[model samples]
Target chain A: MLLQINDVNKQYTNNKVTNTVLDHVSVSVKEGEFISILGPSGCGKSTLLSMVAGLVKPTSGTIMLDGQPIQKPGKDRGMVFQQSALFPWLNVEENVMFPFKKEMNKQEALQKAKHYLQMVQLSNYGKHYPHELSGGMQQRVAIARAFTMDPKVLLMDEPFGALDEQTRTRMHGELERIWLDTKKTVLFVTHSISESIKLSERIIVMGTRPGRIIADIPVTLPRPRRFDAPETIQLEKQINHLLKEEIDKVVKEELSYAENR
Target chain B: MQRIGKQLVFFVGLVIAWELIVRAGGWTPDVMPKPTDVWEAMKRGFSDRTLVYDLQASFTRLFIGLVISLALGTALGILLAKSKTADDTLGALILALQSVPSIVWLPLAIMWFGLNEKAVIFIVVLGGTLVMTINMRMGIKNVPPLYIRAAETMGSKGIDQFIRVILPASVPYAVTGMRLAWAFAWRALMAAEILSTGPGLGYTLKYASDFGDMSLVIAVMILIGVIGSIVDLLLFQRVERNVMKRWGLETN
Candidate 1:
């Protein structure tokens, strides 16, 4: 296993009231596999991803990366945040070059950054700042930055959640191409039903109340899956049926909570 | 270009109004000198090298005081931002000190350093330090959590994180602090020079007032205003724009 998350539990305590965000969640990721943890908005999918990234420790269980207990954020596990999280001060090339500074000199880092930028088809934006780029372009730069590290595992937390529907579709193609070309182990966290079906080799559907895995479904569809593909549509319907119950429960809870307030 | 032209128009109009008032009132040079009279006095001081000497004296003191304040203020500011103990104790003390006017330290400065250059520099440092330190602390504290998290994942830690992420992100705030510090240091310098027998614009103004040389006094006052505004326009504002542009904080 490239990464192993065993019986992970995360609880937040506020003024003696404990909120269980994750409960007994377990998953194993294989090398060079594209895995998507799909869930509703409050399903603790992101929390699980963060634990694997070593950004937050699980309350009870342990996360192992390449047979070692994951302790803290490391270069071996590259993460792409929803907001792009690009350094505003550095240009496109410099931001990608940042992670490689420890292993190489300035010239080598620049060359490697250029190589990744070419991979993402953002070679012309080397000197442009984050604010100068469009939302999709900024995310592309972020993808380039993460791919530059060539980490053992890539973690994405709804990396395309902020894009419009049109831009999001185009980015799905771009991301799939990069994932195919790199063949790095990827654990993607997202709420979109079609996105999980379109991208992942496997989908782990999670439920909300004391968030835990409810279903682990493997996507055996061939490569280059589209939104309107017959198999993609069938799988989307099946996953939506499983997630609707969890999402409806959350909606009812939120409505009652609002009414009480 | 348009902005500069508008400012020039307002400045010329004000000068014209001053000249009219002085001429209509038939004021004596001792009371209120005409615009031409003041300009003549300014030219005379420049030709005789007295004005240059006064400016050099004031600028040297300001430069020294500002350098020391920058070093001490940034160090203390980092400590205040990074350490909880320093934030709780020394931070409280600095806040209390900031509320007290910089002029309030003049007496103590004189007592500690005597009525000399050291006393003047001490007062300038006191005036500038509080503003710089406050601004620097706010700068560091306000760095976005996203930047820190991103840097951490990129394998940056400890002092490397501070240098690469925290410091660069704080550039705008640091520039703002420097601007405020410059203003404070200038005011403190004038007050200190007035008290001490320093060879600067403030001292010249005081000496001229004693002799009722209103033309020379007004000339020095105009020179002080011109120099201060020039430094603000040329140095502080330019650096601020560049930093904002590099950080992509500016739209254009």
Candidate 2:
């Protein structure tokens, strides 16, 4: 396993109430595998990703990357947040070069940034500020930035959730192309079932509120999967059925909790 | 071009209004000099070389005091923001001193530094430091945690993280502090000169006031206001706008 998350748990305390967000979850990822964690909102999918990225500590259990225990955020685990999160002060080139401080000199960093920017088809926008770019472009810049670090794992949390439908679809295609080109391990978290089905080699369906994995479905679809393929459609429907059942359970539980309170 | 035209029209209107008000109020030469009288007085001062000396003195004091305050205040503010011990020990004392008017410290400053350039510079520094410290602390605190984490992930830590990531990111806030500090120092220098009777614009105003030459006083006041506005608009505002534009902080 390139990555191992064993019996991981996380809790948050507000006022006096301790809310358990993740409970005894374990996941293993092979190198260059694309995996998606699918769940309802507030199912702690993003929290799980944060824990894996070492942005937050797991309440119990452990996460290891390449046999080393993860303790803090490192360049080995590059993260792309739901929001663009680009430093407003930095232009596109600078933002892309942000994580390359130790690996490259100024000239080399600039060259690498240009290379990645060209890969993202943003070579002309090297001097453009974040605000000058559209939402999709900004997110692309963010994607370029993460990839430029050459991280062992690429962790994405709803990176395209805010984009429009057309833009999202186009980005999905672009992302798939990038994934094929780079072959970096990706652990993506999303509420969109179709998005997960469309992107990942495996989809882990999670139940809401004290999130637990309800289904781990492997997608055996061929690489460079087409959006309108018959096989893709059949697999998506099967996953959708499982997801609906889990989502119904979540709604019922939420209603009961709200009524009790 | 349209905006500039509107601004020009507004400025001309303001001068016309001022001239009309002076004429309507039946102001004497000693009470409120006419705009023309003040203009003539300014021309005379320019020709005599006294105004140049006074302007140079005031500007030198302002620049020196501003530089010192900016350096010291930024250092102290960062320390306060980062260190609990420093914040707890000095926060209240700094707040108290800031609230007390800069003029109130004049006598003490004079006593400590004597009636020299140091005394005037001391007042300007005291006046400017507090606002700079407060603004800089807020700036540091407001830097996004994600950026800091991002830097750490790239092997940046401690002072390297601060200087490379944190400081450059907080340029807007620091510039704001510098602008505020300039205004405060400018006001304090005028007051310091008035009290200390130093060879500056404020002292020139005071000297004119003592001789009942209200025209010269009015001319000095106009000069001070013009210079202050020019510094803010042309220098500080230009730099701030350029930085913000490069940073994408401005919307349009």
The lDDT per prediction is: 0.89, 0.88
Model 1, runs deviating above 4 Å: A255-261
Show pairs that collide, candidate 1.
Answer: none
- lDDT for A91 (candidate 1): 88
Give the CAPRI class of candidate 2: acceptable
**Residue pairs whose backbone atoms clash in candidate 2:** none
DockQ of each: 0.64, 0.46
Every model: iRMSD: 1.4, 2.2
Write one digit per residue (lDDT tens) for candidate 2, span A1-261.
999999999898999999999988999999999999998887899899988888789999999999999998888988888778788877899889887666568999898889989888999999998888989999999999988888999999899999999999999998998988888899999998778878899999887668778889999888667768998889888877876877788788889999999
True contacts kept of 1: 0.63
